[model samples]
Target: MDESGSAASVDVVLPCLNERGALPWVLSRLPQGYRAIVADNGSTDGSAELAAELGAMVVREGTRGFGSAAHAGLRAATADYVAFCDCDGSMDPAQLPTLLAPILSGTADLVLGSRQPRRGSWPVHARIANVWLAWRLRRLTGGKITDLGPMRAARREGLVSLRLQDRRSGYPLEMFLAAHRHGWRIAELPITYFPRTGKSKITGTIRGTITALRDMSAQLRSARHLCRGGAAPSVRDTEEEA
Candidate 1:
């Protein structure tokens, strides 16, 4: 619902740290007719202020993980469709149109931008990790989610119904698994995966990579429990039944 008395079209929520340098380029490239929300994770580098200056809704969610900040941004989204992408300029905002089209057309409840490996772009370890995690997700949730982290779009109601609870690095996997369990239609669209310009606080650091792997393993376990316990329907099960 919006002030115009019509359903909001789409809202893009980007979780940002101290990415002021990259924010402008990303913001400038966003498609028309979509509002941007920048969830600041306790950044003191004027990121929030800069987002406000750029006319994006700046929300401060302190002491939160990337997932927590993303959840906050989703909660603040007021559109019929909600999309999220990183602020590191690695993912091009122009790719959003194809990802969002399926949701807008009533074909998919959740849409994930599959991070197609670019030539000489991503590091070798990241590619290996992504493949391993995607396989794990398929084994645990029967969802066949190809990309754990990418620019994603989904219906607001479907996303809200998932009640995504992971507040740490595991959020993206949790979201895909939840959607699977709820019988929500999910689809993947190929997108360019570029190496980010700024420092990657998550992947570039040793500690962060270890934490991410742990969180990913935890998500697989959680997904198994949820699907087997009749608490939710795995995406594959739902699709097959339909």
Candidate 2:
């Protein structure tokens, strides 16, 4: 139901890259009434085909990046609300309705699923980095947002209104900070987390973790400066200038 108290369509965007191993379960687990859009980012394992065969609308993103695929899916969505979830099976799509409740009720502009990590589901070092980033966000927003999780739901138009610029690991951060700057009411809901079915291409290895930290930290720094100056700056824009 949307804020108008009527039924609303939802589009769930699953960013894919050889996630064929997990697609079946992930797609199957999506809450009823939610349409799946698998944004395949150059997957070589026939992930796109499998997703299409599984009845999901598959959109190919040649520009390979989490943000590239996610943004593409967002653009393709015609639903009243849009959600993003990892195709690696780390998150359960059944909980999406809970996350989206706030928005549909007009209580929040954006809602993020805070991961309640199960043992071995999250690496200690990566947890530390995530903690630091969350702390930075709290300091910037003065709100209690604990996790920068992949599972989130928001209005499709509000997201498009942000004109989010990042097409990499920084995309999530960029979107969060931009929403804050635009005075969006952001909220978080806790969800159970599990180990990914396949090896994570990002944030599962040292190199990928480092790259994420680099991008996220840059976004944090830019947001900090924005806080001081009341200017909404973006990480990718700052990097492009350099």
Candidate 3:
């Protein structure tokens, strides 16, 4: 794995809230040698215990937001490279190595997995919302990336240095925007997206998708406003609810 030798040195952070039903398959499919750190965000469904029993290192994050759980795992990671994957069955951990290829080969500073959703994977409303967000991103940064996805990989130190601030649904988009603002080389690769196990919250539900769209739209507006004013907004410049 890019001179890092064994893949054991890579840590995969799986942020979870209530993914107890999907824990088994998600943890089981992690590629050999990659460590799984499940950051549990108040899962009353026993998700944290289930992940621990499955041999994943579990960290309890009290804050109830995707970014909080994600950031906590990043701090807990002791690996050369880190990957963020959904604990739900939608994303396959096996595809993480593909996302990390650019980082490992020094071809990119940040690599995001552009999901090629199979049937029944992504809902129409969610997909349309993502299209709008991606279009806004292109207008702001003129970058080639078309999808802002959750499955992503990057060197631990460089990602931490981005100082990403959003703790809610906007977290992933904030990471993308920050990388562009800092002139980090960003790349995207296609990954298969499947229907999630159990009840889907953010992407599957209309209310959840609207919540995420509002958060992301705010981030985009702030970025555009700042960029037009001749100043790239710092990570903290956009104040958002975690």
Candidate 4:
């Protein structure tokens, strides 16, 4: 373990929706000393209760979108840094230190976990979408990001300073784009991706993919406009049902 891991405080945010079956496993694997916060998006499966029982701080977001829940968790974070990962059993919390190391060492402001997918971990359609999206992001931001995988970490204040406003799947991409525009140093580290326990809310169906693409397209356009000297778009709470 790095010495910084012991000194730097971090809060891991798990944005979940009806992930009761996987929450126990995910929470159990979290490293000692890191606060875990579960952002529940109105789950009927008692996920919030279970997470709270497992010693995680549970924040309930009334809205129903990935970005809505994620943003709630980020706001609830009270540590020097915040780390986010899916609570669907696909990402191992034990590997969180890998994402935190660079940020703790002052080498990077943002650390993205590049997924090394296990067999059957990533569907073909999802893989294609991720590849294309990553390529487009690299082009737009002139950054070397390869994967927009969910597992990531960054300084809490820096992330909040970006003033991200997307309330859908576009949230992650918007963060990267804004970080790039602000000249924040970003780095990617490979992490294992396991098969999830439940059906995916996004990337599992064609409709989900299309909806995510639409949201991302809008964010990309805003990014381009900002890069061309246009003023940053006003932040608003817009909900998209996905």
What's the CA error at residue 209 for candidate 3, in Å?
A: 2.1
In order, the Cα lDDT scores of the candidates are 0.78, 0.87, 0.85, 0.87
Badly placed stretches (over 4 Å) of model 4 are 1-5, 232-238
Inter-residue clash pairs, candidate 3 = none
- Where model 1 places Cα greater than 4 Å from the true spot, the runs are 1-8, 230-242
- Tell me the lDDT of model 3 at 149: 92
The C-alpha RMSD in Å for every predicted model, in order, reads 6.6, 2.4, 2.2, 1.9
What is the per-residue lDDT of model 1 for residues 19-120, given as tens digits with 9 covering 90 to 100? 988889889878877788998877768988999999899878764577778888998988878999998888998888888877777788889998876676
lDDT of 3 by residue, 141-189 (tens): 9998888999999889988998877777888988898899889999989
TM-score of each: 0.88, 0.94, 0.92, 0.94
Worst 10 residues of 1 by lDDT: 233-242
Between candidates 1 and 3, the lDDT winner = 3
Q: Candidate 2 regions off by >4 Å?
A: 3-6, 230-234, 237-242
Least accurate 10 contiguous residues by lDDT in model 2: 233-242
- Pitting candidate 3 against candidate 4, the one with the higher TM-score is 4
Superposed Cα deviation of residue 90, candidate 3 (Å): 0.5
**How many collisions between residues are there in candidate 2?**
0
lDDT tens string, model 4, 1-242? 34533556789989998899999999999987788899998898999999999999999988888899999999999898899999999999899988998888889999999999999999998888889988988888778888997899999999999988898888998888888888999899999999999878888877778778777777887888888899856434335565
RMSD of 3: 2.2
